[model samples]
Target: MNKASTARVTLDPENWDEFRSLAHQMIDDTVDYLQNVSSRPAWRPMPAEVRNSFSEPVPHSGVGAAAAYADFRERILPYPNGSIHPRFWGWVQGTGTPLAMMAEMLASAMNPHMAGFNQAPALVEKQVVRWVAELMGYPADASGLLVSGGTMANILGLAVARHARCGFDIRQDGLQGAGKRPKLLVYGSSETHTWVFKGLEFMGLGRAAFRSVPVNVDYTINLALLGEMLQRDKEAGHLPICIIGTAGTVNTGATDDLESLAAIAREHNTWFHVDGAFGAWLRISEKLKSLVAGMEQADSIGLDLHKWVYLPFECACVLVRDAELHRAAFASTVSYLAMADRGVMAGGIPFANLGIDLTRNFKALKVWMQFKAHGIGHIARVIEQNVDDVQYLVDYIRKSKEMELLAPAPLNIACFRYIRSGMPDDALDRLNNEILLRIQEQGIATPSGTTVDGKFAIRVANTNHRSRREDFDALLEAVIRFGREVEMK
Candidate 1:
């Protein structure tokens, strides 16, 4: 046989020792980055040259591992979105733990295809799902699966709810089969995340399917109005299929009366779904758990471990109270993917039967490792501390004459605005917007902006376990300083 004919190509490095050395260096660099994250700015804009570097043509031949790692360290590592920073409170993002980072690396190295079959990864995912269900106070028999994030989790939950409660065979007849019958409707407050509407659209239910109930002064769904809408819609030949209760609204962290919503859902015989996202972790906190009182009563709950549980991105779970119904919504039978009673093809949970996506990564590893390492009690304390820090900021905002509280800080988020006593609403909006930009640009602290009750608000959503009262104090100081500076300019 010709030697040339026998040659094989492999992506593995020819020199394992050199590769190991590079890997060690990469790990050290990551540790250093996390260790000293507090010394760096919460966020920094990427320079034009660095941004332009990404536009380079894709390499047909690989840059050696060390060289590629150098590029990542120089260009990508330094310019994160700042969620990991101690002072970064923007957008309900979590500051991930170093342990989770290690778990991520381990998971990637194994690269398990988590769609199911007899495998330890499959069992790990099942255990993680069980833990999440227990954490959220759901039944031990609840069925769930981890997804990319809150959006996918929520979509899955709603998908199950729609299938189980739509009063027709959604799987077989599709939405069109409802033809000329009462239009199915999902009820939620105006404060519900835009993802719900997107989910409806994706499910072939138009945006009209979502009935937006008005929010009360506290930014929660008004129960009376919700009931009225349900009755009115019913009388008008509309079928209410689901009632979405927000465990925590994105803007203000306002929790709807979930128990009441559950009761209402029961009374109406509609599926009750809760978008817990970051707020479901509040169940772990003794001091704040009461805020999410009725959350467990939800027929389905969508939540994120990445947000409050401090895992890395792309980790969220959707739990359905009825295990069979959950599987029935998404299960598919294919000859090529048939299960077996033994060997590599059998006995483990088939995650593919629970939700969309056949090709899934080992997202459960990081979650399992994080929970095992830190313990839920420790995580709960961190969550409580975050809420306490936000309350401290709220108190500071209340005391400051130049600042106005735009919304109630019920859990871990506070929405407030910098105010000049007589400044018009429009002008104040512009000024606060400028202030927000300046704060981000100046690398002070990153608090996102949102509108509350028609007023622009600097929204501080504290999911960061790294944040402290001092960080929030610093944030307020920068806000006032920028507010005055912007007004003058």
Candidate 2:
């Protein structure tokens, strides 16, 4: 037998002492890492040797976990995408809050498997479902399940939408012989996250099946264009299966006109799906809620708890307006498994029936703890502050002669770049991307890049609550210094 099997063959854990000690060390090391990360480099230029280390084969025997831990301390831990660093504005990812971190520890300790109603995890996830529903101003009866991230949430939501449109029997009989193409059509803004395409691919619909609606200057879907397209599609006898509205697109943080999109969906009887990955928290702020007006009109909504909520990694919720439709998409019965009718003690409203996952993690506890510790108002204020900071940076960019705003800073993400007076379009794009690379190599900050109307621009996303006005000022200084140096050379 293998060492792992041999160790676990007995009822008790054979190396429990060693394992427990290593776990304690891991926790201590992780705590130290998180605490000191603010002072550490925002990123590190990984040498070729270290990159090659990751390619080596696994050591099967004798190499102690302590040795493995040493390697981690020396290498892997130091080199991340710098998500935890306050200066790392590269992506929409958020640095988890301390409260959420502690809650994460507790969650790991409990290790609830939220697959079904028979487990304690079910109750915990149920609490999350209720909380997410309430946040969106929906009824507490709304059903949902926690998934890894926005990608999984979108996949699950699309699956439910498909089932609702095609009927429930698809789950049992499979799509193998399912009649026709079902004319499955999905709608999203041109600026929608690539995950929209990823979800379509996962759902067995090719990228060609989706219709990308035009976006306005702010990068939000133009509702008029969407309406015209919908009318045209209906006239062509095409199925208008689903309409997806973004509450904060990844690129520019522009929210589609949700109320208008919802109205259009209702008029045509199309399933409305909202991918509110980072921006759904706008529901918490009455001031920002107008941006996502009519989000509740969505038949299904996807929200990432990790972002904005500052929860630990991999927690997203897929909420459906009709719980039964969610069930119809994912419900199955096996003779050996605990099967009960809908609404019984161990039966109805089971989260497992709402999504693809069966052996799910207890991602709810951390989010729950965060909300309890920091009230909704505190989060709203933080989000508002982030918005203000982004606006401040936008103003700063506008004032600078060397830098220019590529687009109006909307929400908390601004896309801009260093202006090159005489460079061609292709050359300017390369220089801006080079600046992004150089910034990462310097290990002070890691800003991203995106294209706006065929022009490459620096993408700064203010999703971290830790960012202050000083941080924004420093970023501006860095941009100016870097831009001068790059242009001179």
Candidate 3:
């Protein structure tokens, strides 16, 4: 007997009234934290003592949930990645909505696993996936699965592509089983997100399996160069398995020529996969939809709801045009998961057969609630506002004598560098880096750094809906002030 002396026990609270009181307090604290976030630093370094707090050995007994909430409030919420702050222009991150937070709470309380299930969660997931696919202009019958984030979504898309093109049963026999297989390869611009390459590697397609096609001055894929590479690869008897197009390159937010890339993929008889991780949500913006034109032509696409869609963390989806191909890539015929024609299993659409994860979180609840709480029209308006903010910053940068715009202001990223007359490239690099650290250390704003066309640039990604021109103005002032201060030293 595991516990002979224990009272007949479950994890449920002994007193519902007391538990409800605690829950209400936590909810209020969370709401206050989010509502008042703008008043705090975009990010702050955690103290050494606080860091040491986590070094204690794991305990066999559990602390009460209320006590745990106290630790989270004191040690965790104040030390977040700062992606939710109004001035956080570092990476392509979404500022989550309050609706998503409450929805997640309900999802946790339900505690339902969505893989291979016949339940309400399965229906919600199916409906949300359809809405997402329709928003992105995919066919009504297309197949999709909720995944952790963009990277896994990309992997799932590529896996389907790999299976379809290889013409061999990759599930039964991997890359090696095919005798004398041509060096299978995918093509992408130099500016494609690093996640694609990471996906390729994780899928057993080594990094060398990707061909780096050059991009034009505007950072769009150079069509002529892409044509030449495709032709040359065919002539050399190598397989062009897929063409990976990016709707928004992370460094400068440059969208590739999707229509042109689609044509090339068709001519080459290869799969066209788009990694529209953060930028695909540009579909929400009527003003910017033209930039991602022909996104509908992709055989598959990877999208991150957590990025531009403003959902909570780690929510993304992959949609495949061919439902049969997607199912063939991942479906299992195990005895326990057999489909039924009646009773509990009859009505539910099996989710585990669609992707890598068999036991998946109820990610669809947050997405579904988001759509129901704030309609797509409201989301689109916010997207349009962010794009306008990017343009506003670009205009401000051009008028600033001390700052030189390094790349074209495309989409929502503006790459620029601080310049003082006659500052050598080497000296400018060092000074700008120091300036970045100084601004961050001072908690003025958080903008990440990147090399734009071989020149170090301060890369500002304005994807937050909470941002306004005043925030951008403050960011610029901090950059200039820090740049001048660092130059003096």
Model 1 lDDT per residue over 48-111, tens place: 9999889888799888998989889899998988999998988888888999999999999999
Task: Give the alpha carbon lDDT tens digit for every residue of 1-489 in model 3.
Answer: 576886787899888998999999988888998999889998898999998898878877989888888888898888887888888889788788788989999999998988846788888999999999999999999999999999889889998999889755565775577665677889999988888778789888799998998999899888899889989988988888899999998888889989999999999999999999988989877888998998999999999999888898979999999999999888768666667877666653467888888878898999999998899999888888888898888998899899989999877899998998998887888888888877776777888898877788888887797887899999889888877777443
* Per-residue lDDT of model 2, residues 1-489, tens digit only: 545644334434359898899889898888888877768878897888888888777676645677878988887988888888888788788888777887777877788656665555567678777888998977877878888998888778887877776533544666775664445688889987888788778877778778999898878898888888888887876778889999999888989888988889899888899999989989899888888888988999998987888776878888998988888778887665566654333553366667776666677888778888888899899999989888999998888888888887778899998876887778778888887788778876877888988999999887787776887787788777877778533
The CA lDDT of each predicted structure is 0.90, 0.81, 0.87
Lowest-scoring 10 consecutive residues by lDDT in candidate 3?
167-176
Using TM-score as the measure, the top candidate is: 1
How many steric clashes does model 1 contain? Answer: 0
Task: Tell me the deviation in Å of residue 383 in model 1.
Answer: 0.3
* Residue 212 error, candidate 1, Å: 0.3
What residue runs in model 1 are displaced by over 4 Å at the alpha carbon?
A: 1-6, 174-178
- Candidate 1: residue 87 lDDT (0-100): 86
TM-score for each prediction?
0.97, 0.91, 0.96
- Best-to-worst order by lDDT is 1, 3, 2
